[model samples]
Target: MKTSDRRTARRGAMEQAESGQAAPAMLWRYYAVAIMLVACFIVLVWRVIDLQVINHEFLRSQGDMRTVRVEPIQATRGKILDRNGEPLAVSAPVVTLWANPQEAQENDEGWRKLADLLGMQSDEMVKRLRRHKGKEFIYVQRQLSPETGRLAMDLKLQGLYAKREFKRYYPAGEVAAHIVGITDIDEKGQEGVELAFDQYLRGVNGSKKVLKDRRGYVIKDLSLLQDAQSGADLQLSIDLRLQYMAYRELKAAVEAHNAKSGSLVILDVRTGEVLAMVNQPSFNPNNRDSMNPSGLRNRAVTDLFEPGSTVKPLSIAAALKTGSFTTETRINTSPGFLRLNGQTIRDARDYGTLDLVSIITKSSNVGTSKVALKIGGEAVFETFYQAGFGQSSGIEFPGEAVGVLPNFTKWQPIRLATLSYGYGLSVTALQLAQSYMAIAADGVRRPVSLIRGGQQGVSPQQVMSPGISRHIREMLETVVLKGGTGTRAHVAEYRVAGKTGTTHKVGEHGYADDAYNAVFAGLAPVEKPRLAMAIVMNEPQGSEYYGGEVSAPVFARVVANALRLLNVAPDRAIPMVAGASGSDSKRNGG
Candidate 1:
């Protein structure tokens, strides 16, 4: 029975397979599939047109509004500290007022109130508002006083807001102005150590995306792009106490002598650190009214002048190093006046067959010239160069002048003679301090430093033999004694050693008839020197322009205070030193 049913079923299947009635239904199925595909393509095209053309700009703006508010996170600038962590330059908070012009213009009453509080003319304020009609932000005023800032905020203008920003301030004021320098309104360094270490002193600003409401107040922070980092705190080698002392003394001397300008530098002989550097005509960093662009210069490292007799010890070093003379060697300086090369090199008085030791004590120009001739021109220039003359002191100071030493090939007889007495080549006050440091440190010149601990393990370069340096220092010690040129530079409790210099100022054409630079360079506690300093008084008036008179007294006062502050022990007893302490010849390069 099942076989017979299977045969009928097969016959039915074959019949259905061959049936023509199924054709239209299959065609209808194909048409339905095709229609569905066409409909999908149309929907895709419509969507493309909607996004790429119809709603492009609107969607873009909406996206930007949601994610693109830049909220800046203020960064604090670094503080500059002295060796003992005393604040030299610090950043303090100040208020800056700003406004959205469009919002403020919409609030006429608020704008009027703002104008009144800001002390601005209504017409001018209206004109400014018109100029920047729809601007998002503009500074209404910057660096407002705390009281003014509070009063302006009290007005509560629609778009006006007061924000805090750090402004640089110098607490040490004029006392450390030359070294600490000044910063601009944006807290960018403008001069001195501030300018030198700007990258370290300036901070990195940060910003983030923030959501703001209709009133322009922040709603939520979307994401932080960068985190603000405060600048690195700097520790300098300058001792604040010494800086104050030097500044006080230098200022007093400048005022007392009625000098045009003055510069003083103190160095630690043991480590080659600049302990103090000050200049006269200094401006207080705290008061902008006291600021003069000309007074802003750091003269200790910038101004160049012929070293005058300050370089006498260097000449002596040259003579000894060249095997031309010993400390006991004698030179005939009889009659004083030397005529050569249409120029005359003369001593104040004929020193008369003086030995090297006696020559230094007397500051005999003829004697120094004789030895310089004996050593030859090349030797003299080489000696000065080795002593850090005509070179940057490596103090990292901005605009530091490298003193001038003419090529030895161009030296004439007169040039060599003049150079012997420190009239031809030029040097800065800092250079003089460095050279004297060489003498104090046994002729080994180390790189001068402004950073604390920067001089540790610093290998020194030998510029002269220890023997000759010792002898030179010993002889210099005599210069501050009873019959020397720098007796006024002597301290009461220390064995002082130094040299005095007076050079006619070089004017636009030639040497000025009256203008002069009186300079003193010395090392204190000669037995074991601790500090080396240089002082320069420019164009001292009122009948006293000698280095010993104008600059040495400053040196004495500053050094005495500095030694005491450092707790240095006395190396010598107070002696009855007697001298006039005046320049020997008005016209001579003493």
Candidate 2:
């Protein structure tokens, strides 16, 4: 066959193959692929619309749940200020560490590092985390410094967090601890004035929305839900100068005498404001990790004791009030002893005959009992009741005691005799001070005040006549003279009037034979009183346990400095009496 014929036949066959079913099949495959791509594009567009429009809010909310959070805004607590605007207690900024247990459970090594930083055993921290499993948040430690919180965050622990908070700080330390009181780690008041005024001192915390990173640290603040309101400042009537002076003297006396405890209270006679209130064996509010619970009491207002011979003047006042006796009234105490209802009352020695002034200066139990028997019980009870006995001191301090004063109707003959010399009844140091304060204010009883403006506009009750009060004041002056029981209580240049009291402390069995409470209560500047103070030394274990020996010296030292601090003028010009100097008998000084 010829080559040209074979080439023509082959070309014809190729043309037929291109124009046949193979061409249609290829075209159909291209059309099918284009249709499928269009369908996929339509479905993708519809899904985009659903996600961006219809489900937008739900999806965004889900995202927000992971990163956004509401946080508390810490409020600054109020400050407690002294009368002279000295800061007694304040709130300090601190950090509190917390953990998101769900995230924290993933990193054991990170948690061990946190445990070491927090001074906790790693195993204990693990146990705590296990106990709180599935919890979102848990506290690791509270009341840390900001530096520690920052260091903790630098660890990059997954769920560790830090919140701002406040802790209470006391500037006066143990000196004013009993008065200013203490607060817990959360800034809640636990004792003293802090407990009394907690509502006014604690602040209202606020809240805000914030955006946090994956590490549980705030990155941005979105909006504030509430604004924090700082607590109000509290102004107390306590004079820090006088408080320090009183505390120094009281603490020294408590230690020097080896006393179990001691309390000293100084009040303004005119305003009834507490100038100084101090207690021994006090705990430091700033550092309470090793605090003793026994030393936490404010003994001046909480503890009760018999006034002993300190109430002899009040008995004399009661007798004088009944008009049955005058400052010159005489009573026979020749035998120096009297038997009333099988109970014998005796004086320190035989005082053949005595005037009202002598009975008090001698602190004669027999003479006082005779006077009380003569006047009956009603007169004594009335004077005592009106003098704010057995009633709440208007200070309303927490744990303030209302001393026991039996009604006159319940007084027996022996009871009346014992009451004459401050027995068979109880009174707190504050109540005794208030009774003396009434005398200092010329028989006007004013409510005691702890706050600066606490007693404003309060009317003072006239408990005794002005003349009687003056007469009693003059009689009390002799008690501080050369032969008086309170002679040691006399200030160098200030004429003072006071009474010494020594009472047996009640024990678990009964009145303890050896344990005694030595007390000296007095007012200075006899002509016109300015300050009334009470000093009580509980269970002085030294040989000099008498009120004059143990408690009077304290009075002398405190009054000597306190009067000068208050700018009270000295009244040394007044002169009247001269008596032989001699040591008082066992019970003569009470």
Candidate 3:
């Protein structure tokens, strides 16, 4: 700092001044960095406060979206049981396979393996995968087998998932098809008893909230949702054994006669329970793919026809009820034909004279018309309506037809005469059976039922007088034993009473040229009647078209087997006819 000394002193002073200024500038930069660090810390604290308190619910909801889910809980449908509490229909578990199409398209081998396991073509499966690639969820197959479902999971088919569902299984198949009815793929009742009690049979569905892990497996039950209500069980009045017996006989008769269709129903005389109901050409509920509308029709209640000679019991009972005639009263049925209001009523044989009982026994149209004329239209119509004609039988099943019964005021003179013999008026097979039930039940008409233990809130209605019913029952007995038409319906060991009906099928124009509806209605053990039944065959195309030949045999065979199966004692001591003895009995009893 010498020569550089004098200058150095000033330079040093300058250098010290410059150093002081530089120090201040460097200090300012450091202080500025410290202020920036403090600002950043304040911003982070505000953000933490916003997340932990102010907007905490919104953030928490976002977190829950990944862990908790609301799932649908399917309710179980009701079980259908026979009278003996045997299960006719039950619900079975099934799995539905779904796919995430985008994921599926990425794994060709996985898709192929899934297709093979499901018994589907690989190319078709590929096309479906490609078509639904944009979709996040797609149904691959519904109602998959357990084995196939397991295989799909084992293969780890990309995007493949399974959901549990229920399917209805009918064990007895077509044997009880018409009675039990069937449900659709969605587990909803479609027809028959299933549809009738759908409200009770279909249970209430519920929902559940579940907590899940990242992998989508449920972790906690939460226990905060309503439980599903299972459907109520249905107990039908049908006896499985009796129904089978009736079905077999009716099916055989339909096949033997080459009939278009047929139906049969068995009713308890005292309780008014429908023990058996059968329809031919029925379809198995389990195999619905081949079912047709015709096969699904319940002919017993839906079909209506002219009741023919079967209407005689009602007419005769009416006459006896009003004191217009008696079992011993005789009428001149000479020439076996009578002309009334320009219409002719004829009989199978010319009986010059006959008593009240003989008229029903011979099934003479002329005799019946004469008796009906005595009772008059008002009385007959009232009796028929009271016997449950032109009205539903009140069975639970849907589509029960109320067969035609012309109004009393609308009856023409000729129409009145025709109605006496079950013509110009139509009645269902159920109505026909109920008419006879009144006679066997001693003038009481009970509502027909298909529910076991009897339906609640139903009571029997009085339709006729006890005295008239007893007399008519006696007259009907003569029709099955040593009488006309219904002789074939007589069971050898049990007293049976009934009438035969062979009516020409009515068409749009009028009665068909050759088509006929053969029908038979009867009660067994006339001394103490326990069961009443009716059988009807439509458009039978065999050697015989008469109710005696076509329908009565079916009634006899069914009644014989049903009674024997039920262990009902034989009211009369007589040898069993060939083929009429069931496997439970001997041709010659001990």
Best by TM-score: 3
- For model 3, how does the per-residue alpha-carbon lDDT over 1-590 read when each residue is reduced to its tens digit? 45767997898899999998899899999999999999999999998999999989988899889898887788999999999999999888888888877666554687887788888998889888888889988888988777767777787665777877889999889989988899999889998889988889989988898888754556887655878898999999999999888888889888988999998989988888899999988998998788888899888888788887788788877787787677888888888678877877777657778898877777767777787877788889888888888887767568888888898788776788788888888887887888788888988988889997655688778888887887787787766664355667778888888887888887899888678888888887787888888888999996777887788778788888888988989886444233312111011000
Q: Which portions of model 3 show Cα errors greater than 4 Å?
A: 1-30, 45-60, 213-224, 574-590
Instruction: Give the TM-score comparing model 2 with the true structure, all chains together.
Output: 0.90
Residue 519, model 2: lDDT of 90
User: lDDT score, residue 215, model 1?
Assistant: 59
Ranked by lDDT, the better of candidates 2 and 3 is 2
Candidate order, lDDT descending: 2, 1, 3
Q: How many pairs in model 3 have backbone atoms within 3 A of each other, for residues 3 or more apart or on separate chains, i.e. clashes?
A: 2
Q: Compared with the true structure, what per-residue lDDT tens digits does model 2 show for residues 1-590?
A: 79999999999998998789588899999999999999999999988888889778887888899999999998888999999999999998888988877777544597888889889998888888878878988999998998888888788777778888888889999989988998888888889899999989988989999999888788999999999889899999999999999999999998999999999999898799999999988988877787999899999999999889899888999998888788888999989888888878887788889999988888888889989999989899988888888899899799999999998898889999999898888988889999999988889999999998658777889988888888778787777777777777777688888888988888899888889989988987777898999999999996788887888889989988988999988887445357744246256636
Model 2 clashing-pair count: 0
TM-score of 1: 0.86
The whole-model C-alpha lDDT of candidate 2 against the native structure comes to 0.87
Q: Give the residue spans of candidate 2 off by over 4 A.
A: 1-56, 105-116, 120-134, 573-582
Local accuracy of candidate 1 as per-residue lDDT tens digits, 452-561: 87566657789999899999999988877777777778777888889989999988999898898999999988878899999999999988898877888788888888
Q: Which window of 10 residues has the lowest lDDT sum in candidate 2?
A: 580-589
1 against 2, candidate with superior lDDT: 2
